[model samples]
Target chain A: MTDSIGFGHHQHACTTNNCTTPLAENIREQVQNHPCYSEQAHHYFARMHVAVAPACNIQCHYCNRKYDCANESRPGVVSELLTPDQAVKKVLVVSSEIPQMSVVGIAGPSDPLANPEKTFATFKELAEKAPDLKLCLSTNGLNLPQYVDQIAQYNINHVTITINCVDPVIGAKIYPWIFWQNRRIKGIKAAEILIEQQQKGLEMLLERQILVKVNSVMIPGINDQHLAEVSKIVKAKGAFLHNIMPLLAKPEHGTFYGLTGQRSPTDSELSALQDSCEGEMKMMRHCRQCRADAVGMLGEDRNQDFTLEKIESATVDYQAAMQKRITVQAQITAQMTEKKEQQPHYVQFIPLTSIKRGLTKQKFVHRPILMAVATKGDNLVNEHFGHAKEFLIYEASHTGVRFLRHVKTDLYCHGDDSCGEGETALQRTIHALTGCEVILCARIGYGPWEALVAAGIQPNNDHPYEPIEEAVEKVYKEMIIAGKLDEPLQQQLGA
Target chain B: MSFTINELCTNCWACEPLCPNQAIYEAKPHFLIDSRRCNECEGDYPDPQCASICPIEGAILDSSGQMLNPPGSLTGIPPEKMSMNKI
Candidate 1:
């Protein structure tokens, strides 16, 4: 697992006795530099989605399918819809400008499968023009089975299918209707056809050895309770990863769920569901639920920079860009290796039960606590609390400090005149950090400091610009000395 | 009542130029709809320009504090049926 941690550029480890060695190696190579497939690769590589597919075969309650929504960063929203030729040009321009660009995907202003001619045309052009790039697409699975041959012919290896539910009754609630056989079917009947098609498509893709990633939207009071079962079934069906994304239902986007006051799953609720499903399969925790026209690294969107008007006049030298990308990626891999070596060692505390059995006198228990650090990259606790857009979550215990995942949040301080009106943003940030016991940062304002303390999270700025793992270890020791480790997990989390 | 832009706005400038009444204005951390000048596009387009073009869900609200493009409006899926487990 450690060997798979760096930039995903490392060679695959094939055991001599394993029968599936070649297949395993092939899978590794497929996901190695693919940002969305491998979690570690996202930190180093970049991906771009071209919104060429504008028609969808099914209607999802959570999707609005709006264009020219530059501010919104959700799926199905794009600034400019592009033709197949325009999409190829945009990809070339973006790849040249952002040399780390490795994957070109068609995720939709609508379903890619719904617009097969346009989707495949773009892929065909890309395969001929930019042969070095990895090709992928996200689909609703309505037309996936039909397009499997075309997908393989285009050298597209990664396919994401949004599977909300297996049960038709539950599926009916999420999907109102699906267009099949030149007719629009509604309710349970519609859902049944969609579910059947999705399962068949998934199986067909797996049979073809195409890497399949299942995406499920966690709708609170709806599919949330049923996702664990979905995870188990998908994992059994041989899905490489399961990304359970939260339903982005805001009353404003004007989708069905949003209008009815249907609330999105809270960060804790979403994480809890993810943890439960994680035991069954690999859960994708770092997905940004990027826009259809998203460009750049995960959690960062650069679509505005590569709009149709902007890239129309641009010329791309694919050969030169590919050369630069190789050199840049090599340096990133080396840096990641050095960072791994510099990770600090921590003292693992013996379990309370074991201590009790051995000594029969010790009453205190050492509990593992989660710590969130605000960093502007370089793996350091150097970012101010207000300026942080995301926090790197870590678990510090007697077992030592271990990196977990990053939690994205709204900026609490927008700088200058925005500070006074950041009440809601601050609340959202605090909500996002619900499970963490400590917030390690360079600086925090008085309002947020008080809020953090009230929320049972210790806001610390004692170690400014210090390495994250080392600082986390220091804070863990301090907690131990302060006897805070003796408390239960719930108390530490302020639950 | 006029349409209002809430804190959820990322100030992406999508609605600023599309506003028929010229009510949506740029502000810190988000965009704000000037209530005094805002007419909710009553005499113009059937839908408020800000809410029609705004990407972030629930960012724009009507004078009665209701979202102009509430969740069910776009997909036409009823919200009551969405909570399947409850029923």
Candidate 2:
């Protein structure tokens, strides 16, 4: 594993409610903004849960979850499943209209932790673009212990676990079976393993100082009497709050409890359980039982306003937007090259004035940095140093190549005629190339080439007329093979 | 959610731009995805932007350890039919 991976850097210990680790510090600052964790925040702030996870590992008696999570109590269905890019665009659109959107959750519509790759991808992108938005995930706590390290790495502030029961006897009555390892384990054995895993996972999360919320479904005559015990255990384990939601059973839902004609808890019966659990730990009374693609504030579902169709149409191509900036730069470069090419007599043009500053002194802190390619068009390194006015910069590393930006420069070499100052044109050109570690061009004159060497800028004019990306890739690979990619050449050469 | 780029990667530079997270990096043998940065485009694209554009087959694998763009997956031809055609 490399340090570049998201979850590889945390080395802190935070086991108490008063967390002080870097990971815990990030969580503490973010948790208050989340609507689900703070009831006051819910009224002022809104939360949106995107149903990106499509798989589940366990079975619940009251759940007939298909593609999304079973944690949602209401019979809300997901309209459309979106990829990470589409989801981010949808979040932007929804957040624009509903500015109170403070938390972005991935609470089933399936367990977010069950689909690790899909869940984390959405969080990683949001972490970069929407840093202010607190990230929250709801899971079944089946894989919580396994992903606690990753949760810390991504700085996930709030986690909700649908822990219905603490005792195995009561858990068995709630969950019929669980899929563990590679097979299905049913009956009491399944509930025993699940209870053990949930407790261990909850303890691990608390130890890491991640604010946790427990959701328990109150089934009449089933787990209703046992929920107060559930509240006590989770609160003792440092759970922030416990939400006991009333079960909404319907025969058409095809759940085991629903088909068996199980009774749905009345409003008073549900309130009674909440009232009892309130003594042991704080009880949440405001859960809306949101859908997979739910948007807007809690208790109000505005999914109809921003349908998948609307979101898809509103979704701008993020990659194209970043590249569009480069396209504009490229057009400017093409126009400059075209005007320069149109000049019939290149020799007639002379340097207007001598740049008196003796070598455009640049104080650069030597570091492993980016390089630029001088090209006329066609994304090829075909332009000469003296004739070219623009250079496209690229960030190259072991992982991939990224177009950073284009650097503009002044024309320097004028064929046989000297540009006034003794090697002033050469120095001026090299000065423009400052900060860039290397220059990839088709041709460079001896004076400018030597000047580039003096300035500690490695000039590569050997592979002329090659595709710009290929040339850059070759240089990057050569640097990697030579074990000289990590350190700047200026530092290595002591220039 | 990191994916690996095996020797099959052609370095066509197709996958580099579409990566929303910018995890893919340019390396010696081929372009590599920074494991830390790569989410296999889980929330971004149905098929990874890299594998979707890559001309080379079986170049990228998902988190489930399956080839994202396997042979005949794009062509919609059955594997048996493709093998018979190759012969």
Candidate 3:
């Protein structure tokens, strides 16, 4: 298993609470590095927003997620709605409150382009305002064709479309109707318009080099059995990422976004789908189901600043806004105040940046005595270097010589493919898992290099040419010169 | 709780290292316990260990009644145990 096909990297994705390893992991990794977000990025970093696109040219029963709109929304969840301008203002106000806000996206809240002017304006304003932020837009293909150029023009990185079925008969069950070229088409025709648009949109965006992440919401009673075909077709057409989101049956977010809100697929089912697509296409199992015009990482919400009533007050007036907002927010204020009377003052503020930074610790240290076995078998390992802290022995097809005469430390090495750096992946995983000081390897890749640095693994790749014995001798000599090798090896070598 | 571990476990020990909880152990028949430590990274990131790196099928079972772990993770049931039972 080479870096392209190995399952070592995605293991990190599968460990947390309710996560799924993408079915097609190899393809998933390839797709995730689409210039916007890498596979390594945590979903906690991305935020979601349901756009107020109220105008999807096509309709998928599963496409009913919304922003926190004061207007009617999902049943239990509280949502506040804002226009494009308001969305930006809210974003600027909230980002300072949350640090992991890196990417901004407009998902279904409604089809972004269905409300073309607003979506584009939001994108434009966000780009101009937050130049460092990446932009993502999800849509129904009915409007995708028209916006591909614009998507590319703005250098928007991620574009997800809900494509449930390629077969019109099956597609009809998931989608109710579509508005195409000014006409409302329903049944198979609507399905065809959407599928055609989906295929066309996917093709065009790919041709233009925009990253397309296709989301296929798996419904047990709907298109669950035949979803792999969707993966194959999209992969063939170059859709970079495929996310088969679990169908949430919440009473809110439309009928499908959480419709039945019945139990979604099991981890096994999700893993099966991911496995099916493993070799063929990249799969996105780490979706946050973000809100439209969401600013930040996937599955994260940053608008903790304003509430439904307070939002309108936050509208252009920061000073007068509070006074205006307070009048409108007064009623909810009483409800909150009443609750506060019954509850303690409790708040949960996440220090995400600090934790993420803590996860990545990097420092550089120098060691003169280095040891590596050159012969076959347990060769690449042994006690040799003067400043040996630990000894690692990796199982190699060709073992190295047993250098018994040398300085000692601890023993280490792994024959397991994922245990040691596999020429491309080990440096990173080791750095993340073991906290290695400096990984000495034959070759390295960007993924491993970054992973190591992120884990604070100082890697020294280019080692001087010397036999294992010679290298150990050099270590002792260097240590003696530095006045630290007062050990037995140094004494035996008569340094 | 939509998952399970199938009979495809080979005991190569590839997955034991990947699991966050050290959930897989080298017991009698090459053991693996849920301990529910595998929450699918929901409150955390996403996905459980058995589904991520297991090379063998049926090793890590998901809610769909399928083996999520792939082929290589199914290192085998072990020769010592198999031979001892026969003897």
Candidate 4:
């Protein structure tokens, strides 16, 4: 059955040259095209989530499941819920339309395991119908132990378990109750049972050689500091990646934390936590905290384009679509190869003035710097500075330009009339770009250019329409040449 | 009169901080503008801040159910042409 579904063939199909760190060949192959698992792969591949499972056993303080929510883009929110048959149809339509779509994930409006029958039914249908697409699931782990066998039997290779805390005391604060063993369990006891099941399920999946990624919500006051311990434990237990996501506690979400004024972590705070946990495990920083019905590429959401109504009326030629998808993917791979070859080769440039001053003994070390690029996709820095809703952040060093994550920011310019009045918005944009030393955009007006420069962020319009990675590297090299790499960033901005 | 964010808003966080009156607040389906506090940037700016920066064509609306940044205003692409291209 697994062989018929085209499983295990991906074990040797690693094509992208983005993997800098060495990994087992099979492990590399599993994450090669998975957008959520690999940071670099997100640029070239796409994934869609089917909101098939609408039932959850665990009650998390930060989660309030909402259905038919089209406007908001967040976890546990979906514009439409689909039955197993409807889900299969949607996947076929989406895969046909989006050639880069590779993985189909059943991450809830609720937990997938809690709705086992529906979740497995969808997976079973997709495995049989669309044998080429990879299958994955995100679960709360309350019912994970019971479904591990079925998961492996269905060739579900990737599983993400949201494990916030290993200790039941800390877990109690996050999880108010968990429906287990035909009873509604509450408080620390409920947390204990949930924790035990999560550990056991993680171990069971690892034993079966299935890849597991652990996700933890970084609730500021609750279990914020304890996540490092959770990361250490999961890594020791063979979990491949640890994604420490910020708690989305907006008051309007109606979640317990949201109502009680539990604030979410700042971008800097989340980055700091991820950095601290980086030593213990491979930290995933590129997560978009997508909605259950999210579609298309990682940062861009194309859900409105493939609604159920659209798919129900559309017909799919699976064979032709699959062939076309292959051709498009090959083109993308070729483009990536060309871009890789075009990367600026790193060269150590010691300033002649420093050499004359006999400061040659001081090693001219080039530290990695973060740069934010304004782009409207197509892998180019083409978006205007004022028009960017989100900036794709990249870390450039002597090695190469690595995609870090996208930071959503308030727009700085409204229009010609509201030119100099975007002070509050400009301040927020600058604050969101806390650690970034440079901003690369297609064009910039005078007001924002002055504000950005005053905040110590060099706003450059030199790399218009240039490839993102190449532009970032060029900016890094320019900074190196100007001897500005060693100077400490201006502290006046309070970044 | 106050401005409103209709169903077309993608919750991109563009208009939330740009509101000078701090009238916009995050809601379940989308961001909402407080009618009482929303002066439509009358004294603050020449135009409503939220409508000017919104990327989506018909996302932000005026009190009378008219789009502030209507079709072809931001992208200069006609709505008729956009719909014809949709699959």
Candidate 5:
């Protein structure tokens, strides 16, 4: 938060040895403590990306990094094209394949800040599902100033800002035009606004103690002469690190490269710029500028299909499989609802949506409902669940509850089997999510019985031949009579 | 509301072994949850062994608003539990 600029000493794997190793000190500190970060970290994978700024608004002649939505097998990267669920699944799979994966980064995959919805959603899912994984976002300077507060709330640690040139006069030649406040602005005005926003974003992030890294693309002809100055501006702005990358040119890239057709940065040229950034702003020599969800080495593309692969892998593959599950679930719902409805008058399922609604009804009672046990209903989830469904015998441990029909998890149950399985999963889910501990079941085993006792769950698997709904009501009676539940979990029946 | 594992376990023995539970075991397609034997692990450990060991976050989350562990901090030890936020 101090005004001083910063560049983290932490870097990801720097050698071709493996992209999974932790680089630098900051990440190392976390890595040291993380269960997954030790030498075993080598098993992990790295998914990286370039910023996804659909509209650069400015022109950078040396690079052809921008891409719009197209098919899976395309040249440009996919930006303006992803959903939250898609990103979450990608993080799950990618990190799973290469166990060493410690982070989910959104570097250009579109100026991460510009595509706030896309970026935040992806990170949010990763945080919830894979809290152990770290998150990083890199962006062009355009909208970086806007999302500063959000960065802190999400605990985003590393941010890379692309500052191609600090000199506005030089910047004008590179940027053809820009959209400022809904109006088009030519060269100088665009450059000024951009510089201001970039600086503001950097200052804001530093003040909040988030790591900020500045990236300056070294164009041989255009901003090549402006490297030191650009470095100076960003370093003064409090960038934790500076990455000076050589501009790569491919003639087919587009108008920018076709016209400028400048040569790429030689090895020595890049080294010198890195040296300049080293003294004032710690230089970032390990930048891979990877594609979104890019796996393997930072710079190399090991992905079978980069763009769409990440998205498609997350989609519900068998539409009919989901439909079938939904159909079965509808039946289970009626049965469960009917059972809950039969519970003693004290326990109600009023159909109220939120606590506000229940409070408006002015009725607050501890509806002591029996606890639940979630079974790994999904075929894949079987491994995580050591025991089969046991209402009476439950090993008190957590299990995935796949209430969302679309999501098929590492462990989840589906079908008529899921009715019993899902009910079990749901009961455990209810207790875990709510913290009330009592359950209704047909049977449970001894090992799980003792374990549940240790954790404080009271399992009731004694009922036989009773309507499942009636059995639930009976269980409610036992809890209330035993003083296990004060009233009941309420659902408003009518307005 | 509490959590329990069901049948359908692979007995891959992952969860049971991971369980601070000693609580989990090798069963059918999934694991089982003994209500009499489960407590969301509120006081003993930093995280719910069931959830953490489950290898799934949602697998071991709070049941509705009755959260043993919310999205905030595990240790009420945050300087703010005193409700003061001062050094």
Candidate 6:
């Protein structure tokens, strides 16, 4: 899958017609690190998909209810389906363990939009907690219009819509039926509705400046020849990339097309189709047909290493406790914000007592997760990590940020006074913040940033001179989204 | 006319999805509200959703150069009374 087509240079529709809109640099940065979107980043960054969605609105000829959808080439396969709560916990574990995990997707055993509640719930949780990681959604686009606004609200930056064919004739041949509006419609009618909704959804997303990728499953003697046309339609509507996947036609899979003796396209045939489609749009040829619960880098599935049982056991009680705190914290923060003009002094912490504990012995003792802010007397995150010698540790929580302690650290780089011993200071600085999950600095060098991440701390260099509470609020909110305080460690079981 | 997000605007992403006209976009250093698309939520809502939800004071300014959400908008704490530091 050589991305010689250069998606980075291919801006969305706004770039055309001398558009009034300015190019979004931060949004480009958001996509720049996504492995699926950036060919270069694919070597370094990894992604994970949570199979929370378990229902489909439409059935395709190449799809088997028993297997995952035709969006990816994988046959009937999926890991354990998890509730939204369990999914967030699993994400936190995977994120902490695999630092390269940059995107969390809902490419499912079922349509994400079909189970909107479960899908959106997982997304909302991730949006607040793991805001740094990108959110990717792969939908059949049947219900895309209904959920576009909500999807935008959740800040889903990337979306993948599976449009096998733009032509209803070919679409009718591919899809057996679609359950739309209130009832199921079969044959060409279903294909028409699906196509109409998909195009509408694509336009809406483009209007919102959201990045879109179109995934088309090429079935030999079915829609394979029509894929080049599908690519053009989607590309014109501002789709960022087009992934033409090969049909995995096997009788054992029980797909309608497979049962009808539909032959799979040869590798050369699939590549030839992709090569032709490349001229129409940016073609993605490196797709590995990842499973619903696929994890790690593309072409690699490390889901077996992280199981549902292990995730549930590792994260259950910790998340239950944190969720309660976040709810209360949100209220307190709101009240505090309301009273800001009237009260000049900092507000005191209100002790919460509403968390009802179950008899199940808590296995892990909650570590006082700390976030270090680089400040210079104004209570702002205003200092560069390289220049700072002191850091303020805050007890980060959903309830609120509490001042824990201040630590003096070695400077990461040399000041005007002396040439610094860079590596020694870097190690010392990392060691000084051993217990911290995040270090908020105005600016940081790449060297120390990498070291901090390697030391299990996420270095946040975004907010410069922002209010400490605002930074703390952002961290605490992400803490809620992450659903876990820190990486899971061995602890005594509650007796 | 639509509002423009200046340098003071943080890329908090709080206002991007809130726009009814789907005008907000991410740019380096800050977000930019598309002038052509921004109707300021005239018919959709009584006030602009972007300015209403923005956390930063004076981050978004209207076409006429008036602050829709002026200082003391979010927290009600006056900007003058707040401590100022040069980052």
Candidate 4, residues A323-394: lDDT per residue as tens digits?
887788778766755654453232222343443254343445556788999987667899999888789887
User: Any runs in candidate 6 off by more than 4 Å, and if so which?
Assistant: A1-27, A68-76, A315-495, B1-87
lDDT of 1 by residue, A1-495 (tens): 333432221111222332111126677667766788776667668999998876677778898644345567789888777889999999988998887788999998888987788899999999988887889999999888898988888889999999999999999889877767544567899899999999999999999888999999999999998999999899889997889999987655667777677899876688788767765766677688888999987757888877678888887787787788777766866775566566412223334354345433344546778899997654568899998888878777665565556777753234535343545677878877988999999999999999999988999999999877678878887777666777554565665
Q: Tell me the fnat of candidate 6.
A: 0.00
CA lDDT, candidate 2, residue A163: 91
Per-prediction CA RMSD (Å) = 11.0, 29.4, 24.1, 15.8, 29.5, 28.8
Clashes of each: 12, 15, 94, 0, 121, 6
Task: Look at candidate 4 and tell me the lDDT of residue A474.
Answer: 78
Chain B TM-score for the candidates in order: 0.75, 0.76, 0.56, 0.90, 0.47, 0.87
List, residue by residue over B1-87, the lDDT tens digit for candidate 1.
777778866544546755677887778877787888887778776656666545455678887888765654435656564343121
Fnat for each predicted structure, in order: 0.09, 0.00, 0.00, 0.00, 0.00, 0.00
What are the runs in model 3 whose C-alpha is more than 4 Å off? A1-8, A11-37, A48-52, A63-78, A250-263, A293-300, A308-495, B1-87
Interface RMSD in angstroms for candidate 4 = 20.7
TM-score of each: 0.74, 0.50, 0.47, 0.74, 0.45, 0.51
Candidate 2 per-residue lDDT, tens place, A227-306, comes to 88889899888887788887866544545566566898865577567656665665666566667788876645677788
lDDT of 3 by residue, A1-495 (tens): 112221123322233333332435544443322223343333123344534444344545554322244322221123544577777776555444343445566764556776677778878877776655567777777778888888887778678777888988888777766655433456787787788888999999888767777888777767788888888899889876677766655333434334334456754476567656655565654343444444443322344545544554543533343344334334433443353344221111122223224323222112223232222111122222222232332111111111111111211223445333464234323432342234443344666567657766544434433222223333333433444423343344554
lDDT of each: 0.76, 0.65, 0.49, 0.77, 0.47, 0.68
Best DockQ among the predictions, by candidate number: 1
Q: What DockQ results for candidate 1?
A: 0.06
The better-scoring model by lDDT among 1 and 5 is: 1
Distance from true position, residue A55, model 1, in Å? 0.7
Worst 10 residues of 6 chain A by lDDT: A1-10
